[model samples]
Target chain A: MATDRPLTAKGLATRARIVAAAADLVFHRGAAQVALADVQAAADVSGSQLYHYFTDRDDLLRAVAVHRAAELVANQGPVDTLPALRAWVEANIALIAADNAAGGCRLGSLVPQLAETDPQTRATLSTAFHDWIAHLAAGLTTMTATGVLPPTADPHRLATLLVAALEGGILLAQAQRDITPMRTALEAALDHIASLATSP
Target chain B: MATDRPLTAKGLATRARIVAAAADLVFHRGAAQVALADVQAAADVSGSQLYHYFTDRDDLLRAVAVHRAAELVANQGPVDTLPALRAWVEANIALIAADNAAGGCRLGSLVPQLAETDPQTRATLSTAFHDWIAHLAAGLTTMTATGVLPPTADPHRLATLLVAALEGGILLAQAQRDITPMRTALEAALDHIASLATSP
Candidate 1:
């Protein structure tokens, strides 16, 4: 019943704009400090327009979480080849570095804030991560099938560590505000992952 | 001037109680939502006593961040043996899992919140992390020297990844509300770490 109506083209555009603004504001400020008015102001939309796009702030936040999740996955890049995985990881480090540690792992940040207080919001975050892990798992599976990884390398386990390590990199990077720890840590993780592929 | 005075015994006890209460509250409730009154209520201290212990709420938070940082490093346990490392990780996961993902990482949650807005606060969080990394590096370096790990292994790099992995694992484990990912990821990371050990 809740999923009944699909927004039209114009409506979808407005929704996207709101989500983008909300995410940027939350990243810079914080979810706690951001007001609904800030979202409308940043998006350059009227209050009525904001309400039209989403019923309330929570709805907008959920949409923002979805938007932010897409950006996280998108930043991983197209790791089509074994070498591409390294490139993807380096690009990820650069992307994180560019944010100056101010912009954290979007889905990771939002998940902690929303997970406990709101069940539906928690579910939304859980779904975002589930999709993220699935994408990674699929990538690892393809690499394994391509003989880029040894038969003993479990794609699921490798993918789990990949996600874990990347998130870990982000945590340290943010704390230090320097990319070295994040870069060094990730390179080591990639090296570990690559070591599994070398013999194959 | 700030570090000049030796605190009275009563002052020390009051400050300790306040810090402990603040840690518990902020760790459970989002830090931003936590108020002085909440800390006072939780600590069973009066408003004046709270202010006496901490000049302001930020002071209390900074102290809590430091205390939590100490706890974080302490959680790593004794690194006297390889089996101890394994046991430390196991206990850490159990501690995190027992919380049911309701309370996010205290230092991590506070660090990002401070990153863009407060330089002093950010530095405080950074200091905590620096201490954490240092302890880890010490253990890893010892492992290398004792021939538990290959001399070729960069203990610094490995230690850096280990910290990141633990934070990431906690984040994921909390989100999934399942211990499997955290345990699996940590074990895999440890396995990778152990693979570098020189066989006796």
Candidate 2:
């Protein structure tokens, strides 16, 4: 059974707005820098209203993590084929480039700060990453089944590596305020994947 | 010219102790959570003593970053050969496992939290990473010059990927509290390097 009760349409809208604002603030400002009042101010909601939607700051932070994870998954679009998978990887790199490397991967940046400090937030972020990796793995599996990749290719392991490379690249790019590291890292990951293709 | 004035032998020891204590606190507790008082308490120094050693908290943080970076470089030992490089990669993964994934890479953990919010900190971290990449690239260059690696292998680019993979793998391992992702990701990176070796 679900822990949270279903909300009406109006309640859902207000909750979504609060989450969006919180996510924005947390991403731009470090999580530690953003307080409940900042969230309330950004969301344009009163104190009682903020409490009504989420029990406390930690609860809202967990929600923001989930919201950001879902946004990343959705933005990735579909990835059932090899070309589609490459596109998915490129799209992530493009996002960093588009932002001019100001902000790195939403999950990558936030998860590190919270993972060791808070257990609950760590679990939320871990599950989010596992789910994202699963999506990419499914696409790699399709590639193997469709004869694009060799039978020996392990989709889950490969997917994990791809995610790691992307996160690492994003971190480097953000620190340097340049996108070359991100691009080169992702391209290297793609080349590795290509090497696993069935030899024609 | 040097920006910081030279210190007496006793002063150097005291400053090193302060930095070591602050680095420990910041590593266990997030950077934002550790204050100057905590650093002073941990380092066993008075208010004036702490301030006299460093201009402020930010200066101390930059010192910690530099100290941690040097520690990592020193701990990595020598990485002149392909075997040496593989050993370096394994040592990093071993570090995550040894800590039980409690705290990730010391530099990796702190850099992300500070990089986006503070430009000066970002520059410090970027230089540290660039220095790290340069070290790895130097090893790869030796491999190429010795004819161990193919001439076509770009040492700088390959070094960048290796660093990226290592950081990414460490982040993933810390989040999941498991070392498999890091091991797998790094093995894939090593395999890529092996593929570049020249034939006997």
Judging by DockQ against the true structure, name the best candidate.
2
Listed per model, the TM-scores of chain A against the true chain A are: 0.87, 0.91
Instruction: List the candidate 1 regions with Cα displacement exceeding 4 Å.
Output: A1-8, A73-80, A198-200, B1-6, B73-76
Candidate 2 structure quality by residue, lDDT tens digits, A1-200: 01267888988899899999998887787787889999999989998888888988878888887887788767767777768877887778888888877767788787667776678778877777788789888988988888989888888888888888888888888888899988887788777788778854
Given candidate 2, what's the lDDT at residue B190?
Answer: 77
Taking all chains together, each candidate's TM-score versus the true structure is: 0.91, 0.94
TM-score of 1: 0.91
lDDT of 2 by residue, B1-200 (tens): 01267788998899899999999998888787889999999999998989888888878888888788778767757777988987888778777888866777788777668877778778877887888888888998989999988888888888888888888888888778888888888888877788778964
Write down the C-alpha DockQ for each prediction. Answer: 0.63, 0.68
Show the colliding residue pairs in model 1.
Answer: none
**Poorly placed runs, candidate 2 (over 4 Å):** A1-6, B1-5
Total clashing pairs in model 2: 0
User: DockQ score for model 2, please?
Assistant: 0.68
RMSD to true structure for each model, in Å: 2.7, 2.5
How many residue pairs collide in each prediction? 0, 0
